[model samples]
Target: MTKILISIVGPTAIGKTALSIKLAQHFNTEIISADSRQFFKEMTVGTAVPSTEELNTTKHHFIQHISIKDNYSVGDFERDAISKIESIHKNNDIAIMVGGSGLYVKAVTKGLDHFPDVDKHIRTELNKRLINEGIETLQKQLKSLDFKAYQSIAIDNPQRIIRALEVCIGSGQPYSSFLTKTEKTRPFKVVTIGLSAVRSIIYDRINQRVDIMVNEGLIEEAKELLPNKHLNALNTVGYKELFNYFEGEWTLDFAISEIKKNTRRFAKRQLTWFKKDETIQWFDYTTDINNIINYLEKQS
Candidate 1:
């Protein structure tokens, strides 16, 4: 039997998790989450991890499977996900992978481009600059060093900017130059399902989800992780905004608003990244599960 990996992708708060559960149940297979934020054990409510009821509906892999302190990267996830998919395929003909992290999903479906190992000191210096001068400084440096990366990569993401900058500086070549620009073949067939909505609708959904997260004690979750704010994993949208509030840089209400706004921006960037892949089959967020299942059935 041929193995098929069904990847469910979309922006935040766009129903990827719910749809993935339905697909997993329908196929009688397990799900592998590629959402990087949900991998940390310390981030639950803010990361929007699935509820207990949803996990009971179908088995999931890689959810809260690592600590925030663990130095997990996209490369690490790619290796681990491939191993898990192989194991799952031994028992079932299909496995479901679902997440909004386009890069991680790409890492699983197509192997990552190899770049020269960067110097540790380069990264350390970049992190220092990020803390002192702000992300804009790194963004400008990347733009000057590699215009292509500055335009295409998520510029607002400080981690991404720093990574690109380090690669450019360490190698003395444009970061984009190292991108193989070619897809590496995988052992199993891949079918990507993208969920999307109008820009306004997506923003509205993100705002509502932020409100729900707050109501579900996202503030408390952020508070618990506050001490680790300097950790790369904790420098994320939900936690970062709250950390600012904790620092007296912003009021609680303003922090919550920033969370919603930043999430909406993050969603936009996710869509921008996924849209570059022509292989994805897009669907409205409200698409019927039966219709999606029928589509998958035809592909299988």
Candidate 2:
């Protein structure tokens, strides 16, 4: 029998975690989190790390396994995650992986596109420019240099923006040009399940989830990490908005509102990237877990 890797992917707060947990229990297999944000041990409430109950419900891998201070890249995750999945496959025929991060999922399933080595000075200059002129400046530069990357990547993410810009400037090529269209061969049969809903529903879900995060002390979590808020990992939506409030750039209410608004935009960007991939088997957010399991059964 072929080994299977069932990857659950979708926008934030759209039931990917719930579904992944259910699938793992049914298969009696361990799960691997592909969510990049949840990888950092310091970021829990803001990143929506799974609750203790949900995590203890079954075996899990790669949740809070690293520090935000570490410079872990997609390449690093790809290597680590593949090794974990293979180890899980040793004990079980099926392994589960889930996340809202499309790039991370793609890195594991399809392999990342190859890019040439860039000058360290190029990255330093970009970071200096980011600090001196602000992210908006670099965002605009990326747009002009590589419009395709600007449209596809998370423009609000400074790290992503800087990485793309460095590639564009150093290679004299559009950053998107490095994204190969073909999928790479993998050791196991891979099936991707994408959960989705209407635009208004997705937005409403995001708003509600952010409210719950605040209630769960997301602000306090951000506060504890405030001293090192400059780390790339903390540049995420929930923490960034709260950091602005802490810095007195915005009122508490306004910052919370911005978090909701930014989260909605992030969901929209996720959909845009996932929609382009025709391989994903899309399911409504309300679909029954059993139905999804049956679909996977046929795939295997």
Candidate 3:
């Protein structure tokens, strides 16, 4: 009998969490969250973490289990998630891993290539440049060096751009060169389910979700994490916008709008990322939960 791991991946505000919980409950198994931002214990509302009731309904792992102060990576996630999945499969033949983060999901499903350690000096220099020169500077550099990676990466993200460029210069290779090829081999059978909706509807949901996050104290949550704003986790969408507000670079209204805009752009990147994976079986956002469960069960 082949052990199975189902990865439920999609854009945010597309009901990945609800569908994951349903599948977990039906399969009587635990869920491993692949969401990078939601890993920090300090970030909840802005990260759109699953509610307590939702968690109580089904056991979840790798959600809010790490601190923002820690430097977590895709390599770390791949190592830990595979270990957890192996442990889970010991008791059950199947497990579900779900989230909006394509890179994290891909790292586990298809092994990630090991990049050399980044040089600290290079990282420091890049950080200083980013602080002084701005994200556009890093963006232009990345675009010049690795246009493919630049296109895929969020152009406005100084932190991610710096990290990629750091790795590139440190190793004297293009950052995307690390992803040399896709070589898939695993003991467990991997199945991917993707969720998507119309662009307009998805953007609307994202906007409304930001509003809900505000009502749910995303601002206060951002405030609490503000002291550690320098952390990589704080460089994410929702928190970064609020950080601008706190810096007096933008008003509250402008910050909120920026958050929504960035989030939608992030969603677009996520879609582009996942679309490259040919293994995924996409479904409409309105697909029935039971139908998905039945499809998975049949596949198993």
Candidate 2 local accuracy as lDDT? 0.92
| TM-score of each model, in listed order | 0.98, 0.97, 0.95
lDDT of 2 by residue, 8-95 (tens): 9889999999999999999999999999999999889989899999999999898999998898999999999999999998999999
Q: Which ranges in model 2 have alpha carbons more than 4 Å from their true place? A: none
Taking every candidate in turn, the Cα RMSD to the unseen true structure, in Å, is 1.0, 1.1, 1.5
Pairs with backbone N, CA or C atoms under 3 Å apart (clashes), candidate 3? none
User: Which pairs of residues collide in model 1?
Assistant: none
In candidate 3, how many Å is residue 248 off?
2.2
- Mind giving the per-residue lDDT tens digits that candidate 1 earns over 157-235? 7878988999999999999999986788888999999999999999999999999999999999999899898888988
Tens-place lDDT digits, model 3, residues 1-300:
689999999899999999988888888999999998889899899989999999899889999998988878888999999999999999999999999887789888988866789769998888788777877888988989888889777667676798789888888889988877676687799999999999999999999999999999999989888899876678789998999999899999999999999999989988988999888999999998888878887887
Number of clashing pairs per prediction, in order? 0, 0, 0
